[model samples]
Target: MPPAPASRHRTGRRTHGLLAAAEGLATAAALTAALPADAHDGGGHGHRPGRYQDVQLLSFNDLHGNLESPSGSSGRITELQPDGTTRTVDAGGAEYLATHLRQARAGHPYSVTAAGGDMVGASPLLSGLFHDEPTIEALGKLKLDVTTVGNHEFDEGARELARLQNGGCHPTDGCYTGKRFKGAGFPYLAANVQDEKTGKPILKPYWVWKKKDVRIGFIGVTLEGTPDIVSADGVKGVAFKDEVETINKYAKVLQRQGVRSIVALIHEGGFPASGAYNYDCDSPGAGAGISGPIVDIAKNVTPAVDALVTGHTHAAYVCTVPDPAGRPRMVTSAASFGRLYTDTTLTYDRRTGDIARTAVRSANHVVTRDVPKAADMTDLISRWNALAAPIGNRPIGYISADIDNTGDESPMGDLIADAQLAHGKELDPRTSLALMNPGGVRSGLTYRAKGAEGDGVVTYAEGFTVQPFANTVNLQDFTGAQLVQVLKEQVSGANAAAPKILQPSAGLTYTLDLTRSGADRVVTDSVRLDGHPVDPAATYRVATNSFLAGGGDGFPTLAQGTNDLVGEDDLAALGTYLTAHSSATSPLAPPAADRITVVQ
Candidate 1:
C-alpha cells in the first residue's frame, strides 16, 4: 500500500537545532542535579475528564538493551513510499531514536511512553556487561509508563529479570547488585506469565494510571510460546499461559476496579505486506499477518479493551479488526527494535460506556535521525554510558573485516554458524553441519582500526553482549531426507516460488531457482558429505542451538533428530573460537550453499 499523506507540522529549522542542543545541555545539568521530571502530558493547554478523552499513549518495542551509541546491524529494510518504490532504510542504535521519541512527544497531554518487550537482553557492550542495568536506568529516566515481557527477558532466568525490573536479588558483590536503576514510575505487567507451583501470574497483571480524572489501564503479556522459544535452562520453572484467557480474565478485573478503558500491551504481532507477501503493500488483508493465538485474542478480548498494542514478530501494521460485539476494535503494532511506533488516539464517548470506535485514529511514527532528543532521556542515556565506560569500552580482541548483515547472506550470521559447527564438533564429532536462525544474530561485529586507541577494546563483555542469550548448543541426528525438508521450509512463503532459502553458512552449499515456487523450488536432489554425494537414507548429526533443536523458526525436522549433545553456552563458544583464531583476520567464510538446490 502507498504511504498516506504526511501530517501537517512546521518548525523553524535552525531554531529547532539550537533548541535541541540547549535541551541536551540542560538535561546533562538535570542529571548532575539528580532531580527527575514530574510526569506531565503535553496537552493542548487544558485538562480533560474520562478515559482517553485527551490521552496519548506513546510506545516502542524491541529496544534490545542499547543504552548508548553503538554499531548497528544490516538488512534491506523497506520504507513505505507515498508514490514511488518502497525505499530501503538501515536499522540500529538507540540515541538517534531517543532523540526522535522526545521530539514526537512535544506538546501532547497525558502522553504515556512504554515498550512491548525485548528491552534489556542480547545487548551491546555499553549496557549488557552490567546485566542491562544501564538500559533500565535509561528507561526510568525516559519515564516509561509500562512494558510487557519479551522472551529475551529470560536470558538470565526469572531471578535476573526480576532484579532488572525490581532490584537486584544478589548481594552488592554480585554482578547486577550495585547498579543504579530508576525503578519504573509504572509497573512492568506480565499478566500471562505464571508460577507453576501456585498457578498464579508472576508479575502484576495491569497498571492503572490516572491523569486527573482520566483513568487509563495498561495490561502487559508475553507470548505464550516464550518458554519454548527460550533456552531450556533459562526458563525451567515458569509457565506462559493462554493469551486470550489471561487478557479476558484481567480486563474484567481491571473493569471491576473502576477502570473503563483498557489496552493490551502484548509481545506478539502479525505479518503485514503492501503488495505481495513479503514485498510491498498492495493488498488489504496484509495487516492480518499477526495471526495464530493473537488473532483469537484480538477478536475475542473483552469489550473494555479500547486498543491492542502488540510486538514480537517485528512486523509493521495498523488496522481495526472486529471484536465479538461487531464493534470496531483497533489493533496496532510498531515494527520491532525502535524502528517504528504506532500512534493511535482513542476518544471516550460520554453517553455510551465505551470508547468511540469511529473517533479512533492511528498512525505509525518512524524513528528517524531527523528528530531531536528529549533532554531528560538523552541525559539518562549519557549517565548510564558513563557508568558503563570502564567495563564495556575495554578491548578484548580485533577483527580486520567488516562483519556485515546487509544482505540475506550475512557475514555475521556465517561467523555465528561457524562457531556453532566448531563447538558442536568438539562436544560430539558426529556433528557435520550447523544451522542458525537469521533472527538470532541480534547485532554485528565491527573491528577497530589497527592502531587506534585503548588496551581493553571490545571486551569479552562486548562479544557476549552481541550474543547475550546463553542459548545452548545441541547436536541432533537427522537423515539426509529430513535435512532436505528443512531447506524447503525457508521458501514456504510467496517467495517460496522465488527459490530464496535466505542464507545459510559455509560447510554447506545449495542452489535456488527464482522461477519455481515452494518445496518444488528446492529441486537439486544431490546431498554432499565433504564434497561427495550422500545417501538420502544416511543419518548425519546436525548441530544447532537449543532453540532450533526444539523446533524454533519453523524448523521441525530438528526435533526428530536423535542424540542430543547439549552445551551450556553459545556465546562462550564463539568467544573462545574468536580468541583462538584471532589472526587479525575475519574468521567468517562465504557459504557453500549445499543443503538447498533449485532449478528454473
Candidate 2:
C-alpha cells in the first residue's frame, strides 16, 4: 500500500469549507454498511443490529526491531499468578507476535492494530543493518493501522524519518533488497511534532480507521520533551508540543468532523505498580495505579477521546484515569519490545457516535513463544538473517557470563563505560573517566549463544544490539566543579522526576543517597576518582558518547565540557576493548557494578 497522504492544512485550524467537506465525507462513509474486501469478517456480526458496536483494538509499542526472538531479559514477560507469585514467560519475536495478533483478531472483524511508537529504533543487527526495513515490512504484514512517533524515530533525523514514512531506500545505503522500499503501510501520527518553519505537523496528526459504519479516529503524539532526549541533529527542524494540548486539539477536530469514537496514541507512558503483564492496576485501593507524565496527560485529555494507548516508559498497566469531565477513561500500555500486546474492546455507541466509556475493557497479553510461529514472519527473519549473517556472525570477543543491564548500576553499563574510557585513553592518555547514559545501553550481553556463535562468544551483532545508535566515543575536558555539577544534574533539572543515573567507569566512585532527593542524592563530598577527592579547582578529562557530550538525556551540565575530541564509534570502541581484554583462555567477566556506593 502507498504511504498515507499528508494533510495540506494544519490540524485544528482547518478552514470552514474544509471542515464541511470532511463532515460530508464522514457522513457519506457512515451511511454504508458494506465491509471492504480487506476488512476482517466479524464472524457474521457485520450486520448485527445493536445499539453498540464492539471494536477490537490490538496495540503494542517500543518494538526496537527484534525481528527474531530477543535474547536475555528483553524477550521475557512477567506474568502475575493467582497465588500472587510471578513467573517469567519467554515472549517477543515478530514470528510469535504475528501469531498472537492473528489469533486475537480471529473472530473480531472490526479489529484495528495500532502501536505507541519506537517501532524502528535501537534495533537489532538484523533490522538495524538495513535501517529497519525488515521490521517495517513485518509491521505491514501484521496489518498495523496507525502509530505515533517515538523519540527514537528521530535517531537518524527527520529526513530519514520522512523517508521511512514515505517510500524510498536510504539516501546513502540504497536499496538492500534491490527493490524500492514501500515505507509504512499505516499512517504515522505526529500531532505534537511540528515543522519549525511551517508550524504544521511533521506527519498526519490523526488517522481515521473506517469499517463501513464504524469509524474510530486516532490521534498520536510523542512526549513534548522528545528534543531533550534525542540528538540535536535528529530533532533539528521540528518542534515537539505538549502532549495533552496536542491530543485535546485533535480530539476536537475529529469531533467536529463527526467522528467521535477516538483513541489517543500517546508515546509517553507511566510506571505501573507492578512489573507483571497481568497486574490489576484497577484493583481495590490501587489508587491511580500508575504515575509519571502520562497521568496528567491522560487526566487532562478531552472527554472526546475515549481511551489512551501509551508507551515509552515500557511499563504495562490497564487502568482508568478520569478525563476532564470526571468520567473514567481507559489508559493502557504494553511493555516494550513487543513482549506484550494490549487488547482493548471499545463499545461504540451508534446513537451518540462515541464510545461507551463504561463498557471499555483492556488487558495486556504476553506474546508467548509456545504458539505456532507465523510462517511469513519466519521467512522474513530468515531472509534478513541471511543478509546480516555475513557481518553479524563475526566474533568480537568472549565473555565469562551474562552482563545484564538491570538495576540502578548495571554490569553492562559499567563495562561499556570502562570500554569507552579505554578508547578515550588511547586518544588522550590524560582522559580520567567515562560515564555512559542508561538509555544508550539497549540490551545486555548474554554469554549463551544466540546464533551459531559458540557459548560465551560475543558477536558483532550482539555488541551492535547493545549499542545501536552509532554514537561516537567523545573526549571532553571538565573542571572538578563542572564534573560535580554533571553528577548532580543526573538527579536535578529534567531528571528530577526520573533520575537518569550515568554509569560510572572504574576508579570513579561516589555515594548515592536514596534517602535524599534531587541533587542532594549525590553526596557532594564523597565524589572521588582513584581514591582521591575531586578538588573543585582540578581539571578532568571525561569520555562519553556523542549523545551525552551534547547533553542528550537530562544531563545539560555535560554539554558544557571543553576541548571536544571525537574518536571511533562507541560500538567499535566496545569491540576493541572486549577483544583486547578477553580471550578463549581468559574471557571477560561481568563488571561488579560497585562504582557508585548506594545508601538507601
Displacement of residue 342 (Cα, Å) in model 2 is 0.5
Q: Count the backbone clashes (under 3 Å) in each candidate.
A: 34, 0
Q: Give the Cα lDDT of each candidate.
A: 0.61, 0.82
Tens digits of per-residue lDDT, candidate 2, 1-600, equal 110000000000000011111111101001113333333323364555466678999999999788888899888878776677888878889998899898889878789999998898888888888888888999999999999998878877888889889989788878888999999988988999999999999999999999868889999998887887777777889999999889889988988999999999998888767777767666553225677778888878888899889888877777777788987778888888888888888877666788777667777777777778899999999998998898889999999999998887899999999999999999999999999988888889998898778999999999988888778889999999999999998788877777778899999999989899879999999999999999989989999998889877777788899999999888889999999999988999999999998888
lDDT of 1 by residue, 1-600 (tens): 111101000000000042232121101000011111322223344653332354677777777665544454422235544354555554334666666666667766657776788776666655665666667767776668789887777776777677767764333436443544444455778899887888787788898867655677888998786764566566768899878888889989988887877888988765454411123221244234334345667788877798888776655556566677876666766665565565566664433444555566665655554555556667666666666566545455556556654344467667778778888878887778887766566666655432233322345545654565556778888888888887776566422322223335455766656476566555545445566555578888887777777765555666788877788577777776776666344443333333444444
lDDT of 2: 0.82
Model 2 misplaced regions, further than 4 Å: 1-48, 284-287
User: Candidate 1: worst 10 consecutive residues by lDDT?
Assistant: 7-16
